[model samples]
Target: MILLFAGCPQSSDKISKPGSTQSGTTIHGEKIDISETELLTALNLTRGSQSASEAAKKIAAQTGKNVGRLSFTEAKSLAYDDEAGTFKVKVVGKKNGKNFDKTFNVTGFTHPYASPPQSAIQVEFKFDAGIEENLSIDKYIEKITPNLKAHLTFSFSLQNGKAITLGYDNDYYELTAQVSNSNGELKISPEYKLKYKKKLRGEDETSVSTAYTSAMPVFTGQKKDYFTEKDVFEHIFNKVKDDPELIVADAGSYASSKYAFAMVLNNGGTLFNTGKIAQYVNVYNTKGADNHREIKNITPAMDNVRGGGITADDYEGKLTVNFYISKAEYIADGNTPDDKEKSGSYTVVRSGFKKLPSDISSNVRSVLEFSLGKITDGNGTQDTWKKRRINNTALISMKYTGINSTYDNWFSLNDDLKITGDTSGFYLILNGQDYTSRMPNHQDNFLVPTNGDENVKILIKHLQISKNVGEEELTIRVQFMGGNDTETVKIKPQSY
Candidate 1:
């Protein structure tokens, strides 16, 4: 079947505000509404199919309880049926060592296929401990909620013992197949498989798939009720098949796609393998979705300084420190003005150090450092990184990092969380002004002028220095202001 799926990227921005809605909304003035129907339509599924109901009923039957329906459900489960064409199955399981109520509402329906269109019932369920108790489950909840363990399965067979075409998708990994003869009896057999991708340097694919099946059978025509591997696979496969994304890899495709797929499977989602044809699924989509960057301001806190030496009057005027930061722009490769694919943020932070006379009293240099912690993204998760393991750039600390109060600097920025990527310029900013002039070797010392060019936007300025020789404290006030940001810093004397 030609399934047209819309791959939408999820907003990683963290909403510190607890009341933030989980709907498709962007922090940066972007809003997108993706209804469950729209999502199902995107995955090329029967828009009105009560797949979730079927899955829920199968789960209820396995757990031995009548799990009810949810008012605000995203996806519907499969269903099951009894001899009289009535589907009413329930399953019961312990959660956190306690009993919780889970209901299934799988009702058999008539469809067009064979003369008396075979009534097929399917169901799905997952064992969830809690949001926190299950880390993998929580990740899924964060991405796709209500906390689920593994989706259970159930299916209906026809007169010829042929199972109908059914599928599932967690929007990442999926499994689908046309069973030739499945109308015999209900059987459950748990199976396991490992999925991997081919990595560079002949390395194995960095993806793995874990399968768990509950060997419980409901329609074995036996007094004892239990599920077999087939039932378990069918149970989990039904919900998983709904995702529609489970696909094979195409050469030259982005590796991030594999990472996204692995994440889905790792989070209690089942995947199906459709031999012969490859599946091309979108893990994330920026089009028609709310995905924006979030920025925050975090000035330096808990400050302390240190002294290196003292002067004639038993004073330490030679130990002065100040904090500063540099800003610059980068031209992304293959990025055009119309593309709007800029991938880095202008970071601002604070750092400082004491000034000590280097060699002969004539030459002096301040041992200062700078920090770029002022800008905080609403998404507090640490940067997702990949180490390049290649060293082609020089490493320097805060003070010596930027230009010496001269020459505008820049640094290359990219979405990759590695610092070893291609770097851009490193311009200097003196007192909230761009140091555009080249560093001059003039014998006289003068306050560096700021670059007021249209390209250079003043981010911070109005820096002042104060010192109390007696208390061994040095206070530096930086009236640094920025576009959509601002901050101040103060440092006291201490050890190195």
Candidate 2:
């Protein structure tokens, strides 16, 4: 399941500003400047077991109690009356020998006078009973259902051990919650000691990390379901544009499940050469001295395997790419060719996107040019060429089509061309001698196909590394000794 977070506010309103007393006369020459913001900040200083009202009370007691404050006193006492669902704070003081008073009322504020305390975080959950079609968020509820549930005992902690716990409960679920600072950031865990067992069966007990913290009051949904491509783009591209090496590797449930909701990174497109991540890991560049005797002079290589760079660039009217894919399944046609090593074929079926012209034969350059315009970073010369890699698993399949079909004599494997290696930055030595004998059953081959009988020579091969390093794709013009039969193909890497 893919979890995504949207519309989460980063900060709070009602900013605070501190200053000295204005308008009111000062008593004993002590200054007193108070705004709603300043009062909240000052009230936050009290130690454990102190409520806002209790803290306010402490402030009220100390007004003229010790600090040479303009004489002050609590004109009214706080009370927990069921009729009024809010806290009332009233303090009267003398400033500059003048009389003045301030009153404050807040609905969510704690009434220290009460026996039990409360917190600010309000956790809500939305569920779906049916399946979604587009797989976006169809069958899901916009906001949590009618259950105005609250956890009774909630606690959380950080990787470093610092944490906070609070008890909360309403009608449906009773929970003990804890939040801790995991390294510099906060981690929240809410465990429910749920009362109604059978009714909320699936809700028995689930420990999902809350995105809220002391520093940042916003609680992103549960960690597992909170990330999107926009989040990644904002954090990685916009946030760390200056640092090439800087990376935010999220190894949590939230980081991993984003693939489902991620539309920013298109998995299939023309720029992508290989199909899926597995396809790249399974590539095998078969080349060199394993069988054929007459075939010699082959150069092969594989580069940038693991953590290899994945790139999308415009090439000759196409969004050419160095993509990852599964291994190619090879099969040889059993046609009897004296020197053709049983003309074989290979199929590589990887799940990926392909960028092709509306008409394959149309000017490919036009498509490439258009793509470049869309991706080019402001400075112009190819800044949109970002590097990315995938380790996630994806499905892929391959099947070779031309196994044993006999081609018109001239198209025989003796001269039919096959080339491999180092295309994907991997290398394989390619240098072989062209030979032909005319004793009884001899055929002539062309450097560039002089005629139908004069077959154009081509090479087909794969390469393997000692410990399965990796592979890359290279673009080089391939042709016969003196002919023009050129096509671009990938030089994929393999593990074996």
Candidate 3:
């Protein structure tokens, strides 16, 4: 059986830095010079997927301080300062059910600290260690396959004080054979193995998948401040009378396709004005469906702030709007001049204004936009103009590479692309319409290079264009230090 999987890239973005110069007094009123090696040992004891409270006890014992019931939520890093002869370890969690913040500086060891390699949690398939069975290759395959599967069980505790078990009741196991000789004599060789597929990513979901054991936070449901279907339509009807043109197309007709409308609020105040803007646009197609529009509140986390730099509290917020439109719907709605006049469809044009918070810096507010054309063709037809969006923007181009061959080479826009110009800011304008929303996909859309010479690969899953589209063309506009640059590229349709 053929199985498709979307893999996640390891995060290379530098986590928040640990405070260096803050030297605190020890319990006995004595100064401690914590060595890097000792600090790393303490951090490793309380790393993620481990018992935080238990590790905290061990750490307190090692450091001879009252570290107290320290709960480990995320382990940032452990760096040694040769000049200061101290190791700074950044950790974010709770102590005694309250927020705890501190860096341990152990004295004694003289060697620099060596951090352990970061890795994803591994899942293993273990046969009955006691049972000894002699069977042919066919029998072995049959026993391990879904046809004659054996239940696997595991349990883990969640942050909310709940326990969950897998491979029980409705949960079953499915195995895929990876051996070279399926018909050969049965042998349990270490080289031959079967990989697990969790079916986490949906068929139409266009983004990379993180490993089940990844440390990154997973967002399962709609954000806390998202608008409901009723909320969306109510706002639309309230504003439709004043701006009749905003009701450009029928939401019912376009709801069948895989599209989305999103709004992002970054460094902004509240969701009050954002809901009003949704109503003013009148873009929803269905009366009460959740798929139409998405609203996101982008704010810096408190844990990421170091000393007194730029914290989430400093900036108000940034608001972005994203409206998804299919090529057929776009043509049918007369968004394109050529098709608009030929289709003889009435066009709706609407605009809204927002007042930036007085506290926000003027330099933070800048104009950035992106557009795409010939996004989809239903007839399986190809066109010369049907290519990736490439322009003078950052002197970069994109190509539609197929799925990853190995986990190490997984596709990640954040890991690959290297932008080196004076870039003020950039935003993707969904639906190829200038007046639409600046909805950004937090996982894949906003990308910044980690290094200068990094060769970034643009995977097929990262592009917003649907694989059903015969030939997809995407354009991106980058606002550099000097002027705006627009670049477009062509991508051939391929399944992930």
What lDDT would each prediction earn against the true structure? 0.24, 0.26, 0.27
How well is each residue in 1-496 modelled by candidate 2, as lDDT tens digits? 9998898645212111222222322345444444544444544532223433344345555454323434555434232211122333455665455555555543333222222122323332221211111112211221211221231223333332333334443322233444333442224454433122111111222222222223223222223232222222122222222322221222211111111111112222222212222111222122223211111211111112111122221111111112222112211121122212111211122222222223422332221111101111222121111211223211111113332322112122231111221112222222212211210111211112111122322111111112112323222222211123332333322211
What would the per-residue lDDT of candidate 1 be over residues 370-426, giving only the tens digit for each residue? 211211222211221111121222211112244332222211111211112222111
1-496 per-residue lDDT for model 3 (tens digits): 9999999945222212333323222233222344444444545642322222233233444432333354554443233322222233444444455543455433222211111113212223332210113222344445554522141222333343333333323111111222222234232221111112111111221122222332122211101112232332233333332443332223211110111111111211121234334432333322223232332321111110111111111011211212211122222322332322121222222222122224222221222223322223222223433332333232222222442322222222321111121111111332233212222223432222211112221111223222222235333322221112222233332311
RMSD of 3: 34.3
Worst 10 residues of 1 by lDDT: 306-315
Higher-ranked by lDDT: 2 or 3: 3
Which residue window of length 10 is worst by lDDT in model 3? 255-264
Better of 2 and 3 by TM-score: 2
lDDT score, candidate 3: 0.27
Quote the lDDT for 178 in model 2.
Answer: 43
Model 2, CA-based lDDT: 0.26
Q: Report the alpha-carbon TM-score of model 1 versus the true structure.
A: 0.16
Name the top lDDT candidate: 3
lDDT for 317 in candidate 1 is 16
Runs with alpha carbons beyond 4 Å of true place in candidate 2: 1-92, 95-97, 100-174, 177-432, 435-496
Clashes of each: 92, 80, 40
